[model samples]
Target: MTAFIFNNLNDMQANINRNKLFVASCLSLLVTSLSFGIRAGILGTLGTQFNLSASELASIAATAFWGFPLAVVIGGMVVDAIGMKKLLVIAFLFHLAGIVLTIFAGGFWTLFLSTLLIGIANGTVEAACNPLVATLYPDNKTTKLNHFHLWFPGGIFIGTLIVFLFEKMGIGWQIQVAIMLIPTVIYGYLFSKLDFPVTERVASGVSTAEMYKSVGTPLFVFMFICMFGTAITELFTGQWVGVLLNNVTDNAILILTITTGVMVVGRGLAEPIVHRFSPQGVLLISAILAAIGIYMMSTVTGSMLYFAALIFGIGVCYFWPTMLGFVAENIPKSGALGLNLMGGAGMFAVSIYTLFMGGFYDRLIAEKLPEGASMEAYRTAAAGTTEAAKYAEAQLTAGPDVLKATAIIPVILTVAFAGLVFYMRNKKKPQLAGA
Candidate 1:
């Protein structure tokens, strides 16, 4: 283990074949990115079928986030000890099982468990492959990482559209979920034939103790703390959009489409945007735009609100992958451990918020409806109503308030991230000058 850890990094780096690595990395990313969209689309379909109470549905969505922290921790050792090829195989199998379980998940526990498993797989994918991308292009970490992540939002766009197709065909949600396994199976085959990078932990010869210490800096902590916020902003919006728009319209599908469309646009543009400003500058800007857009999403109404959703999407576009890319670029020597920590922190942040806020947002949104009104009634009443209609002649209204109230989190997150970017910048300046 020590020899593997202390191996000459420069020599080992030369052994890395860039073309095979890129193809394998992109394939891995395609699976990881596509999985998120599948989860989102499946949950959305579940919402329509189950007619779950706002909190109940939100709880299911939150299940996926729970696996984030643990996956990162496990991935750190797994990638270095076992290698990326094996880890990718493990991720694919776990993801395939999660999809299968979701297809058969009948009741609340089953659905929640399946989603949780999927989240775990997703978390592992991020933990292992994110670092792999960094290792594959150590000299161009941010640019390559951003390009690798383009598929995340891009995958969501495809998944979203796929759901629209499935729904139109009156196919069961289970069938739609099962369809994801096709890609998982195919990617497993592709990855099996390829060589992957040894984790930085193994390749760099860094001691575990030193590995932990190096990343324990204030800058790393501060950056991840902000990343936590970005994770919440990204996951929360995708998770809650169906419920958020429930009272606004019966067309849950349409609402999801619009929201996800914004996500696609934002993510598709992420690489260029990161190149233009550096990941840090782009991130700060993302935070500010996300805050304002979330505020508008919550408070505003009509065609105007749709525009706000787009803005919110733009803000979140580069947030998640960019943060991962930043750490990957800056801390190439830490290898999987460093990358896993970032992924873990981000996912853990999402899980915490989802678990707590699922119920909280439900109560907050419910509080605005007329007293004694059932959620069904409130949803029914709010459909087709303007913001003014929400206030006057309220049979039971919930649209504007829920969307608006949810903004509170993003607003707080944006402020916190702004400070984080400032600190990271100052810390890096000294280091760069010293170098």
Candidate 2:
């Protein structure tokens, strides 16, 4: 009776600790998503203040994406050796320094460096938390991971709303940047108080050699490549929402808010959907919806933009978490390194694509301009004159053209996911036959 009681008490205590750790993890992720959301909101202001070209703004934005993969991949490789607690501490410090630097930034280089710091912090959060969540709920990794990742869009919703409201209140971009410090402090405190568990791979006793070897598998390689599409289709579009949809709708930032709102709800309810469709099926369906939604966004205007954003949001809602979960479920031996590699690959691709998209948007605008006319020359022309009107119209057309080009990414994803779904179903059939 005494042993039983003691065991139950220990179990209850563990549950409490798990809940606290989970909350800390969510808060950490919230900081990451907040950075992304607020950065997206502030890009235009940064461009105007710095007098930056489209490509320059994109390069600044891309710095975060670049920094992300570097930290995450390294964090994943060393997470077991140094521990999750230490990694999160690193994240907290980076986030703090980054936010402070960004608030005091004087130009493009400062902005670039600060954004890179925040990106490193963001990557480290995923490094620790993803494996942390997987270890915490071993039996339900997919559902719980989806639940954990809800903060990505949820935090974005919160961040975008802050931007939308504060902009109306005439707040400066620095204040908006500084607001992230609140969550950063809270999460840092929470993590400092808690003890962490080993990653799922470590706990399961999977050999380090085995983990590295599994990452080189054909299936893992295939998924790694596909990650480029899914990530670009989802993150790139969201990050560029303000610029891309500026002409399509007056409420450009609001569209991001609405989309993220949809994602929050969808991710919150991921368990049932994932169970019904299987991860592969969900990926397949999500890709199709994303394709349709982006295509619609390219052509739609006004109120229809909201509807298209809804579909796009729902489509992408399942992507990041599901991809991570699928690997956790199907490629267990790949371990933390595998998980982080997947994320690293995704962000790296987005970083490259951001630069390309920015340059592409500028090129499209240039193409639409009258012969020998530069954007600078047109901007300096008198308001309401033909040159200025032509520039305005060119800017408007460029945004939609960017969207139209982006639609191709999801279309590619749709095909890739379809193949993945077929492969997974066939792979399962042989198991069922053996059973």
Candidate 3:
């Protein structure tokens, strides 16, 4: 069977209703905002109670990423069998459970468990919602996707404010985590009442066998590989920024605000950029630039480090949603399952890297310490150390291997992602061959 493609304007416009699509877009933003708010927002505030060691804290921060792959995969199947609306309900419940668990969590294991569950819920939101949004507004997939993605940064913007408010009020992290539920509840209500379109792949009446067959094509595999790398970049950056900064200096809380602020501004500015470029083109630049940004970040100090983070934020801003747009643009007929599966694969990739990077970062940070040192010796070493002294010492006395390793991972992944984009650009030349 030949696959369907929406290359014409009329066909695309006929596929969606403008007003209903706006409502759906708003829902996507809500999902992005809340998802990130919990993921990154919790890190700055919640760290006080959890008191996770640098590495343990990294794992908790990255745990949500781990659930991404599995949830996306399962969500794909669920969206296909049931519907996007039902999956949203399930996602909401999981999020609620995870948040509640976070409030009562007593130890590393409980917190880890909560982070994992929350990650699962967050993954569900991406898996179900991304495809639904594309279907709701098929006429301008790339532009619309960018608009939908605005909420991710937008949510982070709101989340940052909440973090500030809580800190000012002297309220604990648990309350901050709990407070996110208000948006979730409000969005859940709105999403429940709206009627979403059937997924594009299904609505096109593409058969299951045909859809399954499409996966065997080289193009799908290429996109999947790019997705894996993209996931690692998007997740580990946000998840570990606080830990990395904390590892280097005592003013981690202040640095986190700066990093999140940079991210919000970068993402806010991305809306206009998306209109002028192809999604794949946008991703190609982001991957390469991110590599340079991370490399610079590992080496810089003082105000330079802050500037590098801003640069890094700009590089990574378009990654997550643009990757989805790549799929929606190239694989217009790929129903809910297709989008969900891509999300699942990407997330699963991130989970692996998150665990690996967390362990790697922790082990390396630990190795920086001189061997056989007692608590007394370590405390003495820490005593009277100026904030700059700690970071400078950490930068020097700390082995260069781990810092080098961090840059190497993303650089290698960026090369691979670039290759995938090249493959995708050429793949369309012989599109009928896949059939």
Candidate 4:
């Protein structure tokens, strides 16, 4: 009886652990989405309240995206040595501290600093959970990865919806921002109670030299560049959509809603498609479609904008997860650190462009607006001969050109992907000759 109960208890414990970790992973992503949604909701308010220029707001955005790479890259390097649970705990502390700081921020520098903290938390969560999920479901990496990432979009949907509801009820943006704490608290509790396992690198007894050797190769570096391009293309485009469109349409959140919804379903059903097309085929097709979709977004507006979002959503939906999945499959030796570095590369690209786009918008408007227009013409200005009005007018006109600038990124990606596909096709020729 004792032996039988012990066996049954062990089986029960095994089932409980996987499910708990999955939920914790989802909640971690949920915190990220919540932070994103709340930040988007208040972006305009922050700009007007603090008398912030477009570039200043962009700095905050840059700070947030930049923090991801710092934490993820470092977390990746140490995750195997320190274990996933400690990284997760650090993320939790950052989330708690960052959210509170963001809520109390009254100026540009303060907001930037707080957001940087949150970004660290966000990156650490992703770095730790990604390898955790991959380690748990080794053979089903792509399918499970798709499922794991589904929560990012899913949390986006929930968060944006919550803010939308609060807007209808006349709640302040601060409260909307604070609502993120609910999930943050829940995830913290779950993580506290959960037990984390060693990374696959440790379990498989892979050496430190072996891991370093794999990531140091030429092929890996080239792929890292491709990952950087693809990441910037997807992230920068999404961040700009809110800023440019918020004033143009009151229903701006709906665009985010539609795009994220499509992404959820697309990722949910990724398994069969991944099997049929192969990771390389999927990436090539994704790059092509993303270019076409981003072009349409640059050129379209109104109800038709939703259609454009759908196409763009489906195009970029697979880029993030599939990139991680490919590295996991192709470079298993590099392990969790490799995964973190790949993701960090993407976020680093995002941070750079966020700052650039921010500065670009400020400079673009300044070049046209009368010098005094910067100080006076804002929020409530009307269409007339006033300097503020002219500045406002200039901003409205500047939107399209900014988007056109973004379109260049995906075009570069399309060409890069085609070349990669060609190289992949001929990958074994040299090795075969040596044989």
TM-score of each: 0.84, 0.94, 0.83, 0.90
lDDT tens digits, residues 98-147, model 1?
88888887777888887777777777777777777776665566767766
What tens-digit string does per-residue lDDT give for candidate 3 at 307-363?
776666677777777777776777655556667777787767766776676667545
lDDT, candidate 4, 136-173, per-residue tens: 78777877888888887777777778778887998877
RMSD of 4: 5.1
> Compared with the true structure, what per-residue lDDT tens digits does model 2 show for residues 1-435?
545653454454464489999999999999999998999998988887887888989999999998999999999999999999999999999999999999999999999999999999999999889988987887788999999999999998999998889999999999999999999999999999988877767755578998998899999999999899999988999999898777667789998998999999999999999999999999999999999988888898889999999999998999999999998888888888989999999999999999998999888888999888887777556778999888778888889888889899888888888899888976742110001
Query: Which of candidates 3 and 4 is the stronger one according to TM-score?
Result: 4
Q: Mind sharing the TM-score for model 3? A: 0.83
Backbone-clash count (model 4): 0
Q: Which 10 successive residues of model 3 have the least lDDT summed? A: 426-435
Query: Candidate 2: where are CA atoms >4 Å away?
Result: 1-16, 379-386, 428-435
**Candidate 1 C-alpha RMSD relative to the actual structure:** 4.7
Best by lDDT: 2
Q: Could you tally the backbone clashes for each prediction?
A: 4, 0, 3, 0
Ten residues in sequence with the least summed lDDT for candidate 4: 426-435
| lDDT of every model, 2 decimals | 0.67, 0.89, 0.65, 0.79
- Which model, 1 or 2, shows the larger lDDT? 2
- Sorting all predicted structures by lDDT, with the top scorer first, yields 2, 4, 1, 3
RMSD of 3: 4.7
- Tell me the spans in candidate 4 whose CA falls farther than 4 Å from its real position: 1-16, 370-385, 425-435
State in Å the error of residue 170, model 2. 0.8
Candidate topping TM-score: 2
Candidate 2, poorest ten consecutive residues by summed lDDT: 426-435
lDDT of 1: 0.67
